[model samples]
Target chain A: MTAEDTAAPARRGRPGYDRQQVLEVAVRLFNEQGYDATSVSDLAGELGVTKSALYHHFDSKSAILEVALDDALSGLESALDDAVRSHSDASAQLRALVRGAVGVLTARQSRVTLLLRVRGNSDVEQSALRRRREFDQRVAAIVRAAQAEGMIRADIDAAVATRLIFGMINSLVEWYRPGGPVDPDELADDVLRATFDGLQA
Target chain B: MTAEDTAAPARRGRPGYDRQQVLEVAVRLFNEQGYDATSVSDLAGELGVTKSALYHHFDSKSAILEVALDDALSGLESALDDAVRSHSDASAQLRALVRGAVGVLTARQSRVTLLLRVRGNSDVEQSALRRRREFDQRVAAIVRAAQAEGMIRADIDAAVATRLIFGMINSLVEWYRPGGPVDPDELADDVLRATFDGLQA
Candidate 1:
C-alpha cells in the first residue's frame, strides 16, 4: 500500500491526528504517566480512538518512544554541531552549546524531559542513553579544551563541569514553562551568566 | 507491643534486617524499579522473606515511602537550617547550604535518589514535593537576601538561581558514587567554585 493509503484510515478516525500529532500526544502521556506505566490502551483512550487506529499511526509503543527520543537527541546533537561549526574558540563554542541546548529544551520540553528520564530499561532506552553519554562526553571535551586554552577554569574536572553545567540546563524541563515569565533568551542568559561570571559579586 | 518486640520478628526473618535495613533496601528497590512499580511482594522477594514478614516492619508500601521521603527531606531541611543558623551572610549561607546538601546527598545517595524521583503520584509523594518546594523557596529567599546585601550577583532571578544551584547539586545523584574518586568535600568545592567564581578564568 502507498503511504497515503496507510494514513487514510487513521486520518478519517481522528480527523487531525496524524503521525506527528500521535507522537506529540504519546509523548505528553508518557511524560505525565511515564512510558512504562502508559500503555497503548491509555493512549488510544486519550486520543479517543481505537487501538487499531493508534496502531495505524505507529507499529508499537516502543516505536513511538524511539521517535520521541530521537526528536530530543537529534535536536541536542544538531545544537552541538551548529555550535561547534559556528564557533572556533572553545569558550564561544561552550556558550553557544549552552544557549542552543536551552533553546532545544524549551522548544521541545516534553521530549527532552522524556529523554532525560530514560533509565536504559529497554533496548531503545539503552541506545538513547548511549547517545546521551556521548553528548556529555563531547561537551566535556569542549570543557577540557577550553580549560587547556586557559579560557575555562582548569581546577574542576572537565567531566564534572560538563555534568554540572548541563545539570542546570536540563533542570529547566522540570520547572520552565514555554510562555512563562522567564523567556527562553532571558533564561539562557541567566544560566550563562551564573555559570560563566560566577554568582558572587 | 514494645518496639523491640515488634522489630524482633523482622530481625529474626533475615538476621540483621532491622527497620533501617529494610528501609534502605526498599529505597534501593524503589530507585531501581520506581516506587509505584515495586509492590509488597517484590519487596518481600528482594528481602528473601514472606510478605507477612515484610509487613512486620512497615504497615504498607506507602508507609515505607513516607519514611524514605522523610529521610531525604529531613536531611535537606536540616542542612538548610544549619546553614542559616551558622552563617550571618547570604553568601556563606548559600555556600554552606550547597556544602551541607552535598554531604547529605552523598551520605544518603539512594534515599536522595528516591526523593528526587518522587512525582507526587501519592499523598506521600505530594507531601515530599511540598517540602521540597518549601526548601527551594527558603533557598531562593536566601538568594534574594544575598543579592540585597550585594554579595551574590543580582542580575539573575533569585528563584532561577536557586533552582540552577540545586539542579547542579541534585544531578550528583545521577552520577556520583559514594567512595568514588570525587570526595564530597572536593565535589562541594567544585560546585562552589564553579557557581561563585564562574567557569571562565
Candidate 2:
C-alpha cells in the first residue's frame, strides 16, 4: 500500500480523513503487521496523521479492531439472512449460504483474515469469537434441517458438517489475494461445486 | 499448563531440560498466547528457569518457531509420502492422505495450529509459508492424478479441489480440542465421509 492511498493529513482538527479511510488503512496494516505489533501511533504514521488525530476517530487500537471485525462478519450475517428468507429447499439454502460466504470473504479479504485468525485474547477479540460461534450455530441449524428433510447426508453430525463446509470456505483467507491468480467469482464457483458435488468422477 | 509442566531449572552446565520438552512448552505458549506476544522471558518464567537456560536449548523465539513449524510439517509430509507409496488407486491414496493428516493433526494439535496460523512476517515465518505451499502443491498433484484416473472430478482445478479438502481437515485446529466434545477417531471418520461423499442427498 502506498502513502497516497490515505489522504494526507491536513491538520489535527481537520475533517478531511474519513473514518472508513482510516479503517481501510488500519485493517491492511493490521493484516500485514500482526495486530500486537501494530500501534495507534503506527496507524497514525501510515495515515499521515498525528496520534491525537487518529484517536479522534478511534479511542484505542482495540476499538478499531472491534469495528474491523464487525465489518468482516456483518456481510456474512446479512448474506445468510438473505439466503434463509429466499430459499425453502434445504440444499439450495445451504449452497446459497456457502456462495454468499465466499463473496463476502473475497470482498473483505483483509478484515476476514483478522477476524478468522483472532485468538480471543481481548474483549474485542472475544466478542468477535462469540459472534463467529453464533454464526456457526445458525449454519449448523440449517444443516440439521437439511439432514432431517433428507436433502443431505444424515450420518455426519450437523455441527461437524457445518464446520467442514465453512472450513473449506474460510481457508480462502489464507490464499485468496484480491487481485491475485484466481478471481473471486471463479473461486466461489469452484468452492460451491466442490462442497455440494463431491470431486468424484 | 502449570509450572510443573516445565522441568525445574538445573545447574547451567547440566542437560536437565530436554529439547523436546522445551519445544512442547514453546508450542503451547505460542498457541495460547499469540506468537508475537510470547517471549523468551515468558518461556523461562513458565519453565521456572533463567532466560539463558531457555536460550541454551533454542537460540531465539524465531528459532523455536522454525523447529515447531518443521515438527508440524514433517509429520504431514511423511504421512503423504507413506500414503502415496502404500496405496495403488487415486481415491484410495487420497483417502489415506486425509485420514493420515487428521491423525497427525490430532496428535500434534498445538504445533499444527502454529503452522497453520503463521502469517509469514519474518524469515522463519516466510520459510514456513513456503513449505506449506509446497505441501499444498504435493496434495494438488495427487488430486490431479486422481482426476486423470477417473477417481475424482476433473471439472474443478486440482489445486482448488485439494485446498477445499485440506481446508476442511485443517479446520480441526480451530475446534478440535484433544479431550473436548469430539473424539479424534470419530472426527477423522466424519471428515473423510464428508469429503469423498458430500452432504447432498
Candidate 3:
C-alpha cells in the first residue's frame, strides 16, 4: 500500500459530505448561534462550500432545519418504541424511557436542544412544535398507562407528571456533557431512581 | 391636591431613566432572541430609544448583561437569604428556596431564561456562571442540612441532588407562560411535592 492508502482510512468521508454531516454542522451552528441568526451563507462558509452547493443539498434554510429536527425526533421515537416494547411493566417501561431519553439527549444533545427551544415564531417552528406536542402526548399516554397500573400516582394529573418528567429529562441538555464525570448510562440510572424514589429519605 | 394628582403615585428618585427598567427590557429582548444574537440596536429598538441614548444607560452590551443579571440575582439572593434564616429544617428550607425560586423565575422570566442559556462565551458570561455556581452551592448546603435532619436521602450526593432539583426548577422558563391556568405558586408547590414524593402511588 502507498502513502495515500495509509492515510485514506483516517480521512474517510472527508470530501463529498453527505446529508447527515451537513445537518450535524447546521445543528451546532443553530444551537451555538440563534437559528434566525445563522444564514445559508454562514452554513456554506462553515462547511467550506459555496452557497450554491448548500442550496443544492437543501432548497432553503428552513428546509435544512425542518429535515434536521424531523430526523432527530424520528430517531428518538424509534428508540422509545424499542424501549417500550422491551419492558412488560409500567415501572420497567418508565425506567427504560428515562434511560433511553438520556441516551438520546446526550448522543444528540444539539438536536434535542434545538427541539426544546422552539419559539413558534415561524411556520417551520410551528410545525416542529406541533410534532413536539404530539411526541409529548405519546409519552403522556404511557405515563397514563402507568398510572392505571397502580405504579404511578393516580392523584396527580398525567399531564403534570409528563411535564415534570420532561423538566428533569429535558434539562440534561444544559448540564450534561459526554466525557464528563458520570457516563450517560450511570446518569440515567440516578435520574430514573430520583424520579421513582423521590428526594425524601 | 387634586383627585387626579392624588390618585396616581409620584415617580421619584432617578429622573432620566430607571436602570432597572432598561435592564428589564434588555432581558426580554435577550430571551426573545438569544444572548449572542441580541445586539445593542435590538435592545434600543425594543426600548424605543436611540442607540446613543441606550449607550448612555449602558457602557457596552456586556455591561447591560452584567448589571441586569446582578440585579435579578440580588433579588433572588434576598429571598433565599430570608428563606434560609426562617426555616427550621433543611427540607423546609429547600421548600422555601424552591418557592422563592418560582417567584424569582416568574417575575423575571426573561432574565432567568437568559441565565439558564449562558454559554460562557465571554468574560461576563463566565463570571455570571461562577456566581450561579456559588448560588447552587448555597442551595446544596441547605440540601445537606436536610440530609443531616434525616428528611432527605443520605445515600445520594448533595451536589447531584442539587443539580437535579435545579434542573427541574429551571426548566419552567423553557415551557412556562404567564396565564391563569396553574399560577406560579401552584407550580412551585407541585414541583416541591414531586421532588420529595415519587410519581408512584
- Tens digits of per-residue lDDT, candidate 1, A21-99, equal 8898899999887899899999988877779888888999999999999999999999999999999999999999999
Sorting all predicted structures by lDDT, with the top scorer first, yields 1, 2, 3
Predicted structure with the largest TM-score when compared to the true one: 1
What lDDT would each prediction earn against the true structure? 0.90, 0.86, 0.79
- Candidate that scores best on lDDT: 1
Of candidate 3 chain A, the 10-residue stretch with the lowest lDDT total is: A1-10
User: How far does residue A181 in candidate 3 sit from its true spot (Å)?
Assistant: 1.9
Candidate 2 stretches greater than 4 Å from native: A1-16, B1-17
How many Å off is the CA of A126 in candidate 1?
0.9
Best-to-worst TM-score order: 1, 2, 3
**Each candidate structure's count of clashing pairs:** 0, 1, 0
Local accuracy of candidate 1 as per-residue lDDT tens digits, B1-201:
223664557334354466787898999988888888889999988988778777878899999999988989999999999999998998899999999999999998998999998889889999999999999999999999999999999989999999989888898898998888888899999999988998998
Worst 10 residues of 2 chain A by lDDT: A1-10
Give a tens-digit lDDT track for model 3, residues A1-201.
222234344254334656777898998999888799999999887876668767777889898888878866876787678778998886678778888888888888888888887798889889888887887888888888898898888766787778888789888888788798867887787787678888898
Poorest 10 consecutive residues by lDDT, candidate 1 chain A: A1-10
